[model samples]
Target: MVLSMPSPYKHPSTGVYWLKQRVPARLLAVAKGKSVTVTVDGMPCTVKLGDYIKVSLRTKTIAEAKQRANEAEAEFNRIWLSFENGPVKLTLKQITALAGEMYHAISAALEDDPGEAALWAQRRRERAEVGAKLKVSPAAALMIRPPSLEARLGSWVDGALKQHHLTVTPETYQRLLVEFDRAVGDVATLLERRSRGDYSPDAVAQRFPPVEIEQRVAAPKAAKAVGGDDPTTLTGLLAHKQRTQSKKDDTFDKYRGCLKNFIAFVGHEEVGRITKDDVRRWRDALIKRGLAKKTINDQYLTSLKVALNHGVKEFDLPTNVAANIRDERDAPAPTGSKGYSAEQAKTILQATFRGSSKNLEIPYQRALFWVPWICAYTGLRVTEVTQFRGRHLREENGIPYLLITPDDGSTKGKNAWTTGIHAHLIELGLLDMFRAIGDGPAFYTPYPEGTDLKSLSNHRAKSAGDKIADWVTDELGIAAPGDRPSHAWRHAFTTLSRTYKMDKEARDYMLGSRSQTDAREGYGDWSPEVVDAEINKLPRFDVEASDWRPSLELVPPRPLKSDLPPRRPLRVRKLRAKSA
Candidate 1:
């Protein structure tokens, strides 16, 4: 059966109607960082809107809900178009002709009474003033702040939409705004001419070609439209899986967000109605909105495929419509080396020597100072460096190394691995720093052992990574368009390792990377003594920033565990995966 959902969906259970749409990817960063005021439950409140704008229609009646939803969609389309930087698509001839319609109508209607000519003259002056302030064209000023012609424009825009027999494409909408204002001025001039005892066809409007409606093509061979109930829906699937799957909170959050965005993109909850073309078009929309290709592929597209494939298996659907929907990888690849230039690297490490404006806990402040240096020398991933505890920093056979394992928490790889600490790090009082850390986290506050340990470890590691990345970009000014600030050290390490001709397997072990092609590499031990020899091949960084200071005495001593508040008991969650 075809789904009988309201265009603005009326909830089957709660009877509330809603309009949910994803924010365009171009505006996502802005949306995330800015607060917006929205009306809620009859009261106004300021809130940060995320990826999707999910709002109640504020009416349960089907007809009213549908009307309001269309208006909301239209209004948001205009707002989104305003944010876009793409060029206006309509040709000059078509725009002038469209404006010509407005001119003729205004001229004929005002045959008996033309509003004072001075009123429109003042309107023209106001347009010039607004245009100057905004540093925009006169027509753009008209769109931004229409000079007293909004009431007259209401019917004309509606007529255009009806005449086109479709909603305005963003490009058309942008073009129309410019022409709309020009038309207003043109009509005022016609009225002025009529008042002066002269009535003649407008020479400028006469030259315009006929305004034509842009035709939109429909997708070919869309899937069979199907009804939606509870089981086949993404929200339903998420609830059922959460009961069984052992997923991290961050993973769950990511999937949940993807589901909401996918649903909004498709404009429905009926997963069975989803088509390859539907997913393809949605992918194109995301591309238009300027999402990064890797992000679109890895997070949005991958999660959507997972949801649909899961739905087909669990609900016995006909197929995974998006199963073969591939990536949008046609965009030009970014140019430049992934690693920072040597001078850029030196500048980054040097900036770390500059202290923070506000006081931070000793471990955290030092994390800013040392995370980059540790990554530079050890080739440790940012999370791996930030997540370490004093115990993880241990000496084996009088040689110091870092042990990354699931035993400490989660690792990028499932296995336990060790990489040797460089002699340079040891000479800089790394051992003394660990002595001060004393079994607690080196960069973040440590929770009592075994109490939410996994989550705490993950959270702190992510927090520390973000903190360092922000410090590098914001404070140190190491930002380039495509540079990964936190991950740059890893790239720099790889480049240096290549220059030194370090053994491939040894370098891979230091980077916590595994060999997928080689078989013999599986049998080796990268113990401290083994990797330390390879570690020495990489040269020391000779950074001489004026603010540089290397001292373990600067770090505050770790607080006594005895003085800490009483520990909370560990809360265990039971997870059982459903058998295939």
Candidate 2:
């Protein structure tokens, strides 16, 4: 039997000691939640820590409980202090003083005979650029992106933050960037001075006040003092939901992230103890963070409400506390369907024939040229378009169809079925492109190993889609907050199909939208010829992109994600604390 435990609270019936403490008041709101390393079955499991900390002493004796209690309490205080809003705000002069120190170190380092040839070559190029800018506008020279920025960026800033107990803001960071440029530029100017054989007294270096450094007091590590309680946490519910249900992996990831943030803001894991007030505080905090009201309501708030609603049924939650909490759109919903106009659609399609301005990879450049055309003709989500494999292209009774499903990558819905390949896409030599790529993902590869966010849900398809979207926005200059460039294709497809009087059921099938009224909708499959007929009726984009068609080897054999490096869950969890 265990001799001791934290004696703050005791199980009266079982006569076991426990430690129960209210979460510190200051950390009741947060921008995001962090993983707290916890232990279960002697294995380390990370949990979204909640509002109160309750630990079982696992000992019955008073003296032993007190000793454990002391240790637990000490560690708790240390972690709480770390999370609390840190150090007094740095004054403008003090901030300048910190930047001044960076100037001295950089100038002095370049003063002597430098080490490596490559380093000198790189630095010499950076130094030359600074020298040219200094000649034009010495004041503007420091405003250039800091060349010697990284050398002392961490040590100088970290030392000052710790010394004065300061937190840097974006505004302060902008100032520091200018100050660092000044430091590096001054070094460049000094080097030029030395080369000219005039060893003059350095005026700029003498102006900076020294950044004071102080000895730091190390605190007890959280893993050493931290312990876990086996209770239903908000994120734990999401895990259980994922295991039990058939839902989109991406959606689950989003919900998991939202609930973790909520739990962290409230400060604990005990679901029964959660209050509506706690959730309100979190929502209010999100609002203060200047998140768009739509984002706050749809993504953040809605996610919590959905998770808790499930927790009510599956995990025996008392009630869905966040059920009705929502941020009503602060402004009226913007009127207008998010679809490209005929002219805009043609422009976007025509531009695909031209080379990408961004240095896109071969596969991605192919996606840039083809995805919009495919999206224009087929109305497929950007992901569905990118997931194309040669085998996915099949002939049904002399009509070709592309398969849309989760077998390749994450798709939005369960409407996994054949979609007729528009004749327009075929006309653009899509078939040849598909054949050249072979039986492999046409647009993306398995994310390389050691990717920080490599997961079943956060796959490379999204990355491919994002690359296409960025090009459409930046190169095409089609950026609007209400309308997404990639997604607007869906709206345009629906509109054109309606205008052409294509069968609603065929249109719905192509879009993967579920038919709520008719149960027969899911029973039978659409003939590729029939769908192809309706697809042709919708009409093709009048613009030509034949020149943009791929001539290079488009895709290699399909990448095996299973062969890639295993997922490394914790870059941070591995930091000093693995398991307590």
Candidate 3:
């Protein structure tokens, strides 16, 4: 059998094949040569409106080029037909693709022309309207739709059942079904809107709030009434809070501890029976225990007040007994003017490079050596530095940056930002360590694998920070009485940046501390080059010791397998008798 091949002429200069076709009459004047550009041309309105599509063949081989050209031509013809048919009615799939293309085009244009901002906003509004009309979710309208409601719900149910070995009664099962039905109803509503040409998922969601299924159990015959002496205890309020509010395990645990302590002090009386005098006594007792004023207010009193306030609002208690009790204690004095001094920073860096006196493991040593430098340069919180993964190192416009994000774990205030890596850090071989780790976390080893608990990572990172702090304070003797070694570097960065007179916005951008008060900051127009320049302005720490720099020759630890004696040589039984 004979195979047909595409005939393409090779370009003289580039030695690349070129597929030539006749130019359409409408685009003849615009065409530079005899061959037409393989793009939309017959649709004058599309071309005039700058909405025509152009796809690069992206192949040097004639066969591939020709195949791509044919595909492009088919797509162009489809678009041309749509134009000829008057106002085009697009499919959900086509609309999704167009929305993505439009978004990219608008984004590219916005870089060169700030005036495109208004146009981008207008396009977004139009897309949202169209999405609503099409009954698509906001995510679907944006072209990255999630799984179907039924599929997602089924997977979630199966996973929950398998993982927890959950066994539900008929009432509980019905409640679960009700919740699932609400989710299905949301998706159905969006689909219905698409049929009716109401595409704004946000508008639909706003108009119809999500349904919450309440699971109620019949009260026992001997159960106490609201008017009873033990109406709603602190324990009951805590339980109610857990049911209604979403919180991290660590946060809930802290709240529980504080409430438990308060309950112990005041006795587990009904919330209404608790008085301001009781709250005062608890506060005085905490003060007597030598707790810091801030700790007393934040960890103890604040927690108790929150539960009491919830009781007041939810259960119709007489009043929030702890509401009026305020911590009037004076704020603590500054620890050596907030940040570490230059000499102290150098000493800390040297000690970290020297490793812990307690003979810590290599991973812990690396954490001590690198985390402070990162915090010093980036002004990131200690926990943020601890959560650094190899993949977080990203580049834009030839400038490398650390992508500090909450996706790995909790960030302070849940703010996500990027910090330009200083040249000095690279000189100290931080990138080498990053490359060595390669997609795993950089500092803390034994990262919480296959877990969604942010608290685990946070705790591990905090522990690493504490190790560094211990080295600085106990071994180096650099930190002041009130100064924490891990946090001091952040303050040190601020000091250095201020001394160098860096741009305030750039400083804030690097530190992930930008004020949301300015509406214009939402545009996020700060370029990587500008931020990099600001980061470069901060002075590097001066270390006299040559060994202070972290060693670049680092690699991830390999898993240890138990050594077994070589398998005993297997004795082969003679098969000659069988063969004979």
Q: What is the TM-score of each candidate against the true structure?
A: 0.57, 0.61, 0.53
Pairs of colliding residues, candidate 2: 5-57, 50-267, 50-268, 50-269, 51-267, 51-268
- RMSD in Å for candidate 2, one decimal? 15.8
Clashing residue pairs, backbone N/CA/C < 3 A, model 3: 131-199, 132-198, 132-199, 132-200, 133-197, 133-198, 133-199, 134-194, 135-194
Candidate 2: residue 65 Cα off by (Å) = 42
lDDT of 2 by residue, 324-360 (tens): 8877656666676679888888888888888587776
* Alpha carbon deviation, residue 213, candidate 3 (Å): 42
Model 2 global lDDT (CA atoms, 0 to 1): 0.64
By the lDDT metric, which is better: model 1 or model 3? 1
Model 2 ranges off by over 4 Å: 1-128, 131-230, 287-294, 329-331, 335-337, 446-455, 480-483, 544-548, 554-580
Give the per-residue lDDT digits (tens) of candidate 3, residues 213-249: 1111112133254433223766567656766777655
| Residue runs of model 3 more than 4 Å from their true location after superposition | 1-231, 246-249, 332-335, 453-458, 516-519, 545-580
- Superposed by TM-score, candidate 2 places the C-alpha of residue 168 at a distance from the truth, in angstroms, of 10
lDDT for position 216 in model 1 = 22
Which 10-residue window of candidate 1 scores lowest in summed lDDT?
A: 571-580
lDDT of 1 by residue, 140-194 (tens): 4334434344454645654554332334444455456567767776666667666
Please name the candidate that would achieve the greatest TM-score relative to the true structure. Answer: 2
